[model samples]
Target: MEMQRIMEFPDRIMDKRPRKKPRLTWDMHPPPQPQPPIPPPKVLPTTYHNQEVVNGVAPNHAYPSLFFRGLTRNGSPPWRPDDKDGHYVFAVGDSLTPRYRIIGKMGEGTFGQVLECFDNEKKEAVAIKVVRSINKYREAAMIEIDVLMRLARHDINGARCVQIRNWFDYRNHICIVFEKLGPSLYDFLRKNSYRSFPIDLVREFGRQLLESVAFMHDLCLIHTDLKPENILLVSSEFIKVPDYKFLSRAMKDGSYFKNLPKSSAIKLIDFGSTTFQHQDHSYVVSTRHYRAPEVILGIGWNYPCDLWSVGCILVELCSGEALFQTHENLEHLAMMERVLGPLPPHMIVRADRRADKYFRRGTRLGWPDSSTSRESMRAVWKLHRLPNLIMQHVDHSAGDLIDLLQRLLRYDPAERIKAKEALRHPFFSRDPKRHGYPL
Candidate 1:
């Protein structure tokens, strides 16, 4: 069971994953049977007797797993004090149950906070996501749990996404235990003062990211949000790399330096927004910085939206800054055009009514208009093209990286490269020194 828990993480990343079709869901309950060519289960109304329900998530013939109301079976709050946000109030050495003891706090979000804990029975350190006792958040946690279970069941080798250790209803909060992981890519970059990673490191990170996307796609799921913040380094270890740009200063005072991950192993996380290909995609998805052009234009989207996000993430990893840093839709579109060339005539023509205001008659964008402030226009102008941006930060394999970014960031979703194809791009296969993990 020890070996079964987690071993051979390298094999989990299958480089030759078949180019297959995949989709995912957020409102979606449980995924279909594992593997591609998946056939949908019939939705014949039915019920079960003497059913073993975990947190009211029971096995049903029709929906199979969508029948749960919330994290608790009776929809009743447990006998425990909660914060103003309905988040569980926990502390170090507090007992989550008779079995798990809180060690420290890992992080927090809108849903709830994640606590580092020691599993008494398993005797291992784990991270538990203590969901808010609120009904809506609890329900969302159930969906996420189902999705994680599906991924874990299918990905027997522990590949692509993070692995779940266990889960339960603790004091009415959906306590999900995950194999503890290190800091997120976003956190690492912030701690490093937003210094860019070496090209060799970027290549390894890119490959694993594509493989994870390919795995999710192959399973018919689309992780709507793909950003550095959602990607975690498997280990927290790092080594100091002297800043060559400031080598003289470093030689004298040792002030400027960069921390590079000792290992390139990573895992994808945050599946609360995952949606199936069959589900409606009109509503906006993805973080503002990583949002695809199609999502902004309200022209519907699919797997390619994830590809667009991958392009942004790769750029951020290489340059240590988000590709698009605007909150306004028009400015976001403007940034897209400024960096990746034009927005494509067809994309502008196909823009939904809301997006039309950002465009003029032809392919020209409505910029420098009175509504657009001077600061906004200047920011857009300051951005370099895809090639120039990559070349500015990366010293080697810039050409291959640029070409891959072009395909991944294509304004036309139909023309965007698939995750499987992106994994095979010359960038990954170019140099032996660039492909493998950091030594």
Candidate 2:
């Protein structure tokens, strides 16, 4: 389907370019966890958003015991002491409000937990993102609400992104209600044991993804986080396809079969990090694996950064793994050079002051000489180039996809393919039937 431009803005002003700052390493941040029940001697404060938790109590102020998990990991669960963290402690069958009842938990993240609730008033299921009570998260939630409202106003049909049903402030937590949808692409891949999708399926997914991205870009908005986890299928129904490899290895029950989504329709979610094209384009954005080269280099990024992320997501969908799996900036850049070839000389020339160290002399990236260990060097060297990597997993349709991916993964943002242009590429234009690929 074509992406209908909802609204258009006159030429954008890229005025605020932030100065170079120290690179923020990809630290595996955990959810807002409270301290253990008992306090030890000389307890220090764990500060966040000016709210300090000293021995589970705010400095001088006693922490409220308002957090409860709906379900526990233990097989048969029971109500336990609620947590004192900022998270809104909830339980199954508990009422979020006069109209919504918590049926189950959808998921949890750094921000807070998502609960699957039955909207008694609407007589339907909905997923509600319950934001933490901390001031920062609440502020971010407001931004997401504004962005969703803007998109909903422009996207009359709600074709490209998730639809927000409703939202409210309960106990200081910003609760956002959304239409219930299927598992994220990342969840599906993991449940399928990281099996790569059929080339035909990948094409369908790629087409829709670019279209959604185009829709966002047309509105002058950028979805900083576009990983598979943020892309949810419209339906959970699927068909089981034979997995001969699993059968060969030793199958049990339905292990020899893999589930394939019956439909490719998707909706993009997670707009908390979404930014306006004219906003400050300096701070780092996007997840570690899908981050653009310019972001890691501390160079200013714009809409093209989303395109780069789309490129990475497509690669992960095809290969059953992330394109570049590293947390450190130097190693991440080194791996990029290994897969997509060297960084563009001009890009290297314009590297941010803090990111300049990753590149040495001129455009050459210091890798083997600067690697922390032989294993790290080996990991970078083991990566196959763009075409080779595509050919490894995809047959009968590698040429068009390779050409398309190369353009999308181009080191220079200017040279990278835009979402609208990428939708017109042969990779999406061609018929799979003529190529003899599975449906």
Compared with the true structure, model 2 gives a TM-score of 0.80
The Cα RMSD in angstroms, rounded to one decimal, for candidate 2 relative to the true structure is: 13.2
- What is the number of backbone collisions in each predicted candidate, taken in the order shown? 11, 2
Q: State every prediction's TM-score relative to the real structure.
A: 0.81, 0.80
lDDT of 2 by residue, 268-307 (tens): 9989999989887647899888999989987788989999
lDDT of candidate 1 over 203-274, digit per residue (tens)? 889999999999999989999989887898887667776678767563434435567777789999888788
Q: What is candidate 2's CA lDDT for residue 82?
A: 28
Model 1 scores worst on lDDT over the 10 consecutive residues at 1-10
**Pairs that collide, model 2:** 67-89, 68-89
Candidate 1 lDDT at 363 equals 65
